[model samples]
Target: MRNPSRTMLYSAAGIATAFILVVAVNIIAGALYVRGDLTADRVFTLSDSTKKIISEINAPVHIRFYYSKNNPQTPGNIKSFASRVEDLLEEYRMASHGVLKIEKLDPAPYSDAEDSATMEGIESQLLSSGERIYCGMSISCLDKSQNLPFLSPQKENLLEYEITRAIWDVTHDVRKTVGVISALPVLGMNKVQPTAESIASGKFAPPGPWIPFKELEDTYEIRKIPLDAESIGSDINLLLLVQPVGMSAKCMLAVDQYLLRGGRLIVMLDPVSLYSIVKSATDPSYRETVSCNLPAFLNAWGIKFNNNIVVADMTFATRIDMPQTKITYPSILDITSKGINRSNTVTALLEKIGLVFAGFFEFTEGATLKKEVLIHSTADSMPVSSFLANRPEMLVRNFSPSGKVFDMAVILRGDFKTAFPDAGKNLLRKSISSNSAVVLVADTDFLFNDVCVQFSKDQFGRKFYVRKNDNVSFLHNLVGYLSGDNTMINIRGRQTITRPFLRIGALKSKSEQEYKNKILDLEKDLIQTQEKINNLQKENSGRYSKYVFSPEQQTELRKFQEKSVAARKELKNLRKGLYGSIDRIENTLKWLNISLVPAIVIIVGLSWAAAVRRRSSSK
Candidate 1:
């Protein structure tokens, strides 16, 4: 009923006022708040170790972000992936209750604080426009005594572990040390195999990269020795036993004492030595060999190694070229990338890798067991005889794969009393209150040189190929997990190292085979159609001149040409789909985001609105 012009002006004024109020409130809240994003599924996040370390943060964690809001040289480096680094750090603050503090600093071109960030190791690559920008973050606990330089979150799918690990290392008191023992050099593995003469001549040749033990120096302390049972102690946190040959009775007893005292160990024992072709290739009538047995100690702890049976799986079989033009792929004990435990911390961030000549273990009756199958072969796997005298042929068939796979590698956990109850009495050590801890891997070939490597020496006298430890991400995870605190074990989230297939499932083997055959048949048809189109013109070669003159011939040629064009278009679409799944996956991720981010936002808003209404009523 009032003046129209006055009403319009009032409406406009109200909108403007609300905008100002929102901006002012946001600014005030931001001063004391840090922000992070969980929108990315493949974001660089913190590792479980790092997460635990952050959770234990008693003092506030201060973060000063130095970024160029407007980068001149790179034009839009401010929009680069580095911004995600800020988002991740904010996540840490959100998880940290007021203990984590965050601050943002926009350094001017000629500012002293910018120089300080640079001096503190926050590096920035200069761009062409002569504009220098701040591109990283610095975290400090207490003084700069514990400073973390985080430049950018990683751009990989599984980068959270590395980011978190760096944070943990910087935030924690000291890095945990893992103890390693093997016949091979721990790190600095040679690309080329040292001649047998090298080991015999004492030249000290390191093992290859694929030899699972490569790169031990970066993450652990390698205690290279011939371990007898008596040497396990509190000084050693994790013991890695790789193909221990002739471990003296004294050494075995020492190991028993160590486990009895509640120590952890990773044992790799092979059923037979496929380690050296130089060692056994010439024995045409080779028998199976059993390499490692805990004898009595393993049994006492409810862990038993049946060193006699060789595991053969159908799904993950390896193709070995045998002597009789035998290029048949035996369900030859392969524990490739597909075989690793996907949900476990040790095997999560891994791809395809393989193992060979593996053994299996059983828990003795009445043995307390917390068992996890760390590695297994395909469904078409079974046991072959495991003796040096038995020919490898028992497992070697004409690629007749059946889906009979079994566990070649396992992780056994529980309180283990020493095989010799009196063994630890010498040192006067009591069993752990909850009983001591230990780890056992039945197959030594899992870490050997040949099984983990592929080699080709070049004319330039260099040898190189895929490294066995290329698959060692899981191994490193295992090392980090066992030696580390449990809180750190699942800092981010706990995923399995291996996933169990639905053995009793709705999908049968025949259905799987038919599905495969259908795809193959479609591919064949596509190929045949293309070939027919190419030959159509050739089929008319005899009457080339006549056909060129004939109306009927010309009409038929036009039909063929049109049909061929349509077929080509269809083929192109199919090819593009192979590379287009990622886009579809991303779209699906976006659609599913409603299940995560949007829901959180709505809940928070509703709760805030409810609180505001309640306060107004009270007033």
Candidate 2:
């Protein structure tokens, strides 16, 4: 006989004690800082570059997050992302150890907080009910300020990168100056064909800069240099030389001197440039072959590239629309993750890059400088002559795989000897005493407008250019690497938590290879059968129109028709088998993922129950 009131009192006391313990634990956690990032990719952990930048903060930089909480106008997904953004900011705050202060605000509609947010440049979205929802960030240090107008969920993957870049920009006052000396129309200066009306009006405006060039202008000061400039200005931080054909000896000497003085360089040299063809079709003066090289300068830098050869890879071929036909052009490479340098910070995170008429490079044997290949072709790649690359039809006819990998891009670092050491060049250092850096890309048309950008009209009929690939990102990252800004370069292509299944991928690849062989055999049979039918029909048509076909011709036609049908059936069956194998494997994986944990739990439960029964019997 137990007292129900006493038992109820004990239960109540236990619940109160548990609540107090939880509250105390939470309070202690808030006072102390601890972060455990258990994700495989360390998605929550701040990158080393970000931490380094934060650690060097001398002045106090404050970030204000203006979020609309519990507003019916705000979408649920955005609210979740807002919480993630706050957590990320907390990581930054902890990493900064007090140099970075964060202020989170919930701006109610028409409230003073909302007014403050609007003044700080945070944008607000209006709902159907006339309510405003704010989701953005504003960072300020003393007088200088930087604002992210809106934080869209579409760009959530770039949240950390955007915030870190904003902080770095607000703190840094100087922008790097990049000097360009391009033979092609990189500045897009009056290159379009003259129209009759425009000619009559005498109104010809210079063409706007290409999309990539426009993007660069947003972050860097672009200074275009003349082709025959005698000297490179000392104020330039990085020098970009594209298609440097027919350059004067003095200009080459000037470039040599610039590099010897520790200047960063990005050189785009191509053996065959399709973009040049388009530009030269209208203007003969700009019509130049893709043979441009400063041999004296390149040899001294421990780089050797044949300006007469172009690399063509079947594994990475990009399709081109030609006259009356579409074909995959091996010279225009569509480089994917497999071809990029995953270990190098400059190219590690890039997905796909498009390059036209690319060439390959190799270092001279016994070279003094250290070289690292940044982009490479597949094993089924070979170097083709520029003659084949110029003619689209001939390129396909003469294509063959060399079964070797070629280097499409590389970084050369260390001391470089001047090629004209004894040529009485004034003030020439003859060699770089300390290590210097230069990036050599074997393609020139990668940044061209026709290849890198696509134009589209919005619903309002306004036109805009969109990047077709990561060429713009690659160029920006290269310049950032040259300017010694590691924060933007390191976080541009990072994938925090997307892990792929390598084993399943390998199986799929194996199946594809088998299927490819089967398809090839079927195509051969179909081609042969069609040829026989064509000959029979040609002989019959060439004779009198009223003449009937011979018995042998009739038999041959029927046989060929039956052969075509059988080939089609076999091809269909091959595809079915290939898909079936892949589907079965996928289903097995799904079942394992759904049941493995529960199966283990049941096994453990049964073992415990049996042990308890045995112990009772023994007692």
Candidate 3:
């Protein structure tokens, strides 16, 4: 007995209210910068450094992201990556607080956007359907523009860093100048006297400016400072001393004063640099023993340095070719994350760092400077004297592992006192005003090209470099941090996408070790049996007669062969069992991940429904 018109009007009013509320909610969401990141690593979240960089921008910066989205020719992966890029760009816009403006363009063929993209030198890839797809971004500030050309999906880990760095570079107009002070050929010492054979062969160039120097040149201006040079150039933003040897008092004073005056310093001292061996091997006049020391300067900075000792780590030794065969040299340490200082910005994101014939350091008594160790040797590390360290053969013969940790690198930051307090005009400051920092690395060979890069030549005779480690990134991050570009400071080397199960990994390693031991034992037995057979044949051999084996030798051979077959079968079984165990674990994890949550939800829902029915029945 209700009025139909009145009921219909009330229903219409309710529908209208619901629609209005939905529209209002959508508008509010669109206006706000709100996103819930459910990713485990929070990969979509902007880092604090990125947020700071965006917030510090005083001028407007335009970021044009050109992507071919929903195109029939574009790959699905590229489209997905473009969506991620868009999300990141949106995050940046939100963080910038209206300073950053982003524009997304589809740049259709023959369109004005396409023409603009071409003019900006953005690289385009031709799809399988003959349609060219663009997936690059360009950032501009005032008159300065930086183009990424092509944003490679393979380099997604470094995408955020690259974008931030480009924006920083465009906004900041000056490139830092670095001064190099080293006796170990960083500036590529030209031959004072050239040989006639070298001239004829067209290989008569300098020994090297070294590979690390060449890499640094792409970022900073490297000016060579001689040991005899009395003063460091005022224009030098950072001072790098590599394998510094035979430095005079004046040179030491200049360095001390430079650091006191707010100049950044990177000191690399080697107990025995391997590069020096190669350099001196060719020239008799070149010093066979290369060591550097600034005792007074170091003592003043509250650091105790020993140029006569080398750190040898058994747990982290790198295998290298020595004379006739490859052997693991304890003096050549490969420092992993266990040795790296994660709290410091310089070594935080670095994965592996290689050092050759490195030295170790310790803090002196009553030290004033604040010390932070950036690299550490394992508990299985010990120090070897410089004399034994210089000879590679001695390292193989005499080196013994000592279960003790050693400091490989350290950063000291504090107001430092003058090394020569009484010397007038020679001392710059008795006490430095602002807190200055200097990083001390225990090895010089970490910068060597052979250790850090793999040089290759293509079919067309073009040479290119493939980086072997994150050394270059580490160096850049350190230099950038020292130069006050905090945007690049927190950037890690690269993100690793895949994470393994530790329990499974441990099981696999243990099984593999056991299998290896069994194989080695079987191989030893086989070798002994072969030797016995050979001896029997040699003892019975005659010039025109047949080579015969004794019954004992034959019996031993049969036994060894049987043992070998048994070992092979055992190895095969071990491998199969190892894989089976791994597969079972993986399958169990997969099943749990796929069903546990849904099963819990169903159980909870059923329990609630049963409780509600029981309550109704009780009522």
Best by TM-score: 2
Candidate that beats the other on TM-score, 2 or 3, i.e. the better one: 2
CA-only RMSD, every prediction:
11.9, 6.0, 7.4
Please identify which of the two predictions, 1 or 3, would achieve the higher lDDT against the true structure: 3
lDDT for 269 in candidate 1 is 70
- CA lDDT of each prediction against the hidden true structure: 0.55, 0.79, 0.76
Q: Which model, 1 or 3, shows the larger TM-score?
A: 3
Error of 2 at 329 (Å): 7.2
TM-score of 2: 0.75
Tens digit of lDDT per residue, candidate 2, span 1-619? 7799998999999999999999999999988867688986676777887888898888999999999986877878878989888889989998899999999988897888898898999988766667778889999877778898778765576678778878887787788899998777776675577788888999967688877788677567899888888999999999999888877777877888888888989998988777777757876666675467767777777678898888887677765556832455667788877789989988987777888888888878888888888899988678888777755445554556688899988898887777678768475678776757889999988888778777775322335555566787788899888877766776655533455554654565455445655665676688898888787777777546433678887887898999999998887787677667768878998999999999999999999999999998897
Question: What TM-score does structure 3 among the candidates reach?
Answer: 0.70
> Which regions of candidate 3 deviate over 4 angstroms?
1-34, 39-41, 126-131, 182-230, 244-253, 260-262, 270-338, 342-358, 364-370, 383-403, 414-434, 444-473, 493-547, 550-619
- Clashing residue pair totals per candidate (backbone < 3 A): 54, 0, 3
**Higher-lDDT candidate of 2 and 3:** 2
Per-residue CA lDDT of candidate 1, range 198-272, in tens? Answer: 879888656434434544443445555554444655678777776665666677767766666677777767666
